[model samples]
Target: MKKFKCGVCANTVYFENFRCLNCGHALGFHPGRLEMAALAPGRDKRLREARRGPSSPMVYCANEAHGVCNWIVTSHPDSGFCDACVLNRTIPNLADPQNVRAWGDFERAKKRLIYSLLRFGLPLDGAPAGKGPLTFDFINDAVTGHLDGVITIAVGEADSVERERQRQAMDETYRSLLGHLRHESGHYYWMLLIEDTGRIDEFRHLFGDEREDYGAALERHHVQGPPPDWSLRHVSAYASSHPWEDWAETWAHYLHMVDAIDTSVAHRIEPRSTRFFSGTARAIRGQDAYRSNSFSTLIERWVPLTLALNDINRSMGHSDFYPFVIPEIAVAKLGFVHRLIRESTT
Candidate 1:
């Protein structure tokens, strides 16, 4: 979510930009460096870099041919997709124009999730022998969207109308393509790091025992909804359904908060408090979120940003961008996620 610019003209650009808006130079993401590079012609169809350190020979991922990916392969000499794209088990049908657009949105959101995970040095093993990697299935079918080892994203979820309808039906404050990807991936990582590893006891103590009957719990949740005082612990109403849901929902919000601070850092969006310790708001700076070990700095940045954004949204007669509150219990859960991710990096 950091700011990107063209290496050729220094013009502001977005992560999804294929070519510089001002310079018209082709662009590709260098995953190794965690930066974007402007592209120049090279041998065959290969390209020579122009940014993010010295210019080097590189080629776009094969998915670029279909306009779905912007990442480049950094190691292999032969042309291929980047490490993130290689996990693709099933992509949407590209022949249809609407499917192609929906697939593009899905890829963009997926890449954002992968990018953040990689920035934290999380392991992303390649697609396994036959089963698949932490793969994705962007399907247009009757199957419910979920993750049972492989992440599934319904193509209709990409449509703004359909997404909004579903969000309203579920009475969620926030929902998006990125949110779905992050939440589902949370389930995948929970099994990988918590269940398979030895963090089960700690996880259970914080999020509750996952041994709870998921089907019945969910059934009760949908029928009765979350308790009125659910915010005292769970991040969302859906999170109150079960221990597994609590972990995934909390994990997704952790991603949301961190990513938001990252963008705030990249843009130098810092908020300063005027009063001393007697005041309510905490002081926060853009750089603190990325550098500080404690969640205090990140939460300090998050609270004010949410406040400002929510007020601005009201001016435009729209719903709050982040309508949820983070009480002490939710903060404790987020701190656990923070420690786990940082520990993995070390």
Candidate 2:
């Protein structure tokens, strides 16, 4: 989540930027360099001699029926699917032109998810017996996006308008396609951690008995709202529904904090040598500085910053951007995530 700029015009850019709005310079993410760079239009968009390494050859989605994405992938890095495409458990039908548009929108968001995973060095894999590293199917089944029947991802999530409508109905501001990826990755990682033998107990204590029936739990949640006063314990209302979901919700928040802090640091948003906010005034002003650095440091700075952000959002006629409070117990859970991620790379 480092800050990026157009190499051609120096315009500040985002990881998802395909072309600079300021100068119209074509852009591609050079994962080797861990930065987005401008592509000088030619045969080879792959960046050679990138400081991190040579660029991985990538191609955009051919399903770009409406030009939603310009993402590319490594030509021969173990699969034909781009990093984002690998995570799809189901994709919409290609025969229907509208499905193509939906897929394109999904691709844009999915690529953003993949970028975070790669940026943070998270592990990724596909379902068994697939040629691709990750498998997805845009299911038309009844449970596709429902809380019932083995984790349904409703096809409607691919539609921006539909997602927004749902978000409004639910009184949520921060939900997005990328949010879905982080949430789902929680399920994937829980499978990994529980199967690891050493981490199962800790997982159970913090997230609840993930062994419980997922479908039953989800059904109960839909029928009856989360435990009254759920906010005292969980980060989101939906998280209180199940242990697996609690972990996923927290995991997504962890990523949000980590990425937000990293982006802040990359841009020198904070004055150097300052730690956590020194005084009340410092604490107020220091929220802006919290964006800098790794998750470890972010946790240190986020306490005051989140408080400030909550108040600021309230003043602006919007609900809290970060709706949940990170309880002491949740902080411990997050610490486990930080340690696990650090240990993985080490």
In model 2, which regions exceed 4 Å deviation? 41-66, 75-81, 86-89, 94-98, 126-133, 139-152, 164-174, 267-296
lDDT of 2 by residue, 1-346 (tens): 6678877778899877778999886776655456676765334643332223444444543332246555555433455444555445566677888777666666666666666767666556523322124334455543433221123355678777888898887656567776876687666665554544587887788778887998899899888877887777777888888888888888888877776555555664533333444533333133332223344455775665566667888999987857667776777777777766665545
lDDT of 1 by residue, 27-146 (tens): 989889988889988878779976445556788889898898988897544537687787777877678999999889889999999988877777675233222247778889735345
- Count of residue pairs whose backbone atoms collide, per candidate: 1, 20
Candidate with maximal lDDT:
1
TM-score of 1: 0.91
How far in Å is the alpha carbon of 238 misplaced in model 1? 0.2
Q: What is the lDDT of residue 65 in candidate 1?
A: 87
Alpha-carbon local distance difference test for all models: 0.81, 0.63
TM-scores for the candidates: 0.91, 0.76
Error of 2 at 41 (Å): 4.3
